[model samples]
Target: MLKEKVALITGSTSGIGLATAHVLAQQGINLVLHGLVSATEGQALANDFIAQYGINAIFDDADLQDVASIERLITKAISTMGSVDILVNNAGIQHTQSAESFPLEKWNAIIAINLSAAFHAIQFALPAMKRQGWGRIINVASVHGLVGSVNKSAYCAAKHGLVGLTKVLALECAEQGITVNAICPGWVDTPLINDQISAIAKQQDSSFEQAKYQLVTAKQPLPEMMAPAQIGEFILFLCSDSAKSITGAALPMDGAWTAQ
Candidate 1:
């Protein structure tokens, strides 16, 4: 069903977003790569998909924090690839600090990128999806959406709000041929996480391995960091015809983080 369809994935320059783009492309889907990366880098990534998959693709370096930019991305993507049948809200950022010590600017930024961007994208994409009578809206939330942790006030709040929005939107679109859902992933061994581990090592004055181990096993009993491609594959499944009935669900890719 994904064949020839267009999927605009936010934050597609690297990590899970990029991985998801590859899987979607493999399924014969066209793409619109969106991220904060340079235009050159973004176009290069888009060209790679076109060269490898022989599918239509383009890059948009839109500032997700700007509602207008988000709208332009969808508009341009539709003009480029025909229509956006799949909308992946995957762009995100993180800042860890005590709630009391959390910078107001950081909190606002997190809420804007992590939460509001999804809103703007979905709002803009919904009409097209509803008009076509078939679409998938996947919000790349985090394990923090389901549960809380220390020193992650802004991220936690934004993710929680995302999950809530996912449910509400799913309910509203339940009758429509559109599905809205959230994917709550655990610690994936991405660059974003590697940086966090480095910070942990620095603060604790410990080896990288020690900090990595502690961080991975802190709540996730699996004691292993998941691969970014795994999340991508899972998303592909959600976009499949089999997952048409799945909506308003907050599926966890965490290794039993919330289980404990």
Candidate 2:
């Protein structure tokens, strides 16, 4: 369905973003992948995609925390890919700490990358999408966007801001053929969460599997982590014509975390 379309996914070198890129490519969407990986690694990933899918693919090393860098990256993507029809703002960072003791720099960096960068990407991508008269903006938010989490002040705040941004942008673009929405996912088994799981294992003196189970089932009734590929599939669905009417929605794939 995405044949001839171009998608720009940020922080796509690993985890959810990478999975989403793969899914999009499978649907024949050309990709503009962004991440903080070394240039060599980024090129290698791009080459792998080109070889596997035979779809046009390129990678840009974007520092999501830097607005100028993001702008440059978006410009470069547009220049190389011609135009972006689907934009997935999936770049973000997580820090767990008490709000009172939260490092100000860390808070600022999280907000800039997780929240502000989305705004910047939309701002830059919208004109081209408007010219094309159709577009999709997908924000990879977290369950924290719909609820709260302990010791995750920065993450919660940034995701909440992203959710709000999605709503407002969706409303603004409703008259146009553009849709804006957020995917609020629960605990996903990604490399990013590996550190947290390892820390938990050490703290409890349990095996990695035990710690993973404890974390996954803490507040969620689910016994497993949601796969990044699942989230990618949902995104693919959203980019379809059937989801054209679905806008300004914060759809949760939280394993019922927000259900209780």
For model 1, residues 90-142, the per-residue Cα lDDT tens digits are 99999999998899999999999999999999999989899889999999999
The runs of at least 3 residues in candidate 2 whose Cα sits more than 4 Å from the true structure, single-residue gaps closed, are none
Worst 10 residues of 1 by lDDT: 187-196
TM-score (all chains, Cα) for each model: 0.96, 0.97
- Cα lDDT tens digits for candidate 2, 60-154: 99888777888898889889999999999999898889999999999999999999999999998999899889999999998999899889999
User: Candidate 1 versus the native: TM-score?
Assistant: 0.96
Measured by TM-score, the strongest candidate is 2
Measured on C-alpha atoms, candidate 2 has an lDDT of: 0.93
Error of 2 at 20 (Å): 0.6
Residue 216, candidate 2: Cα error in Å is: 1.2
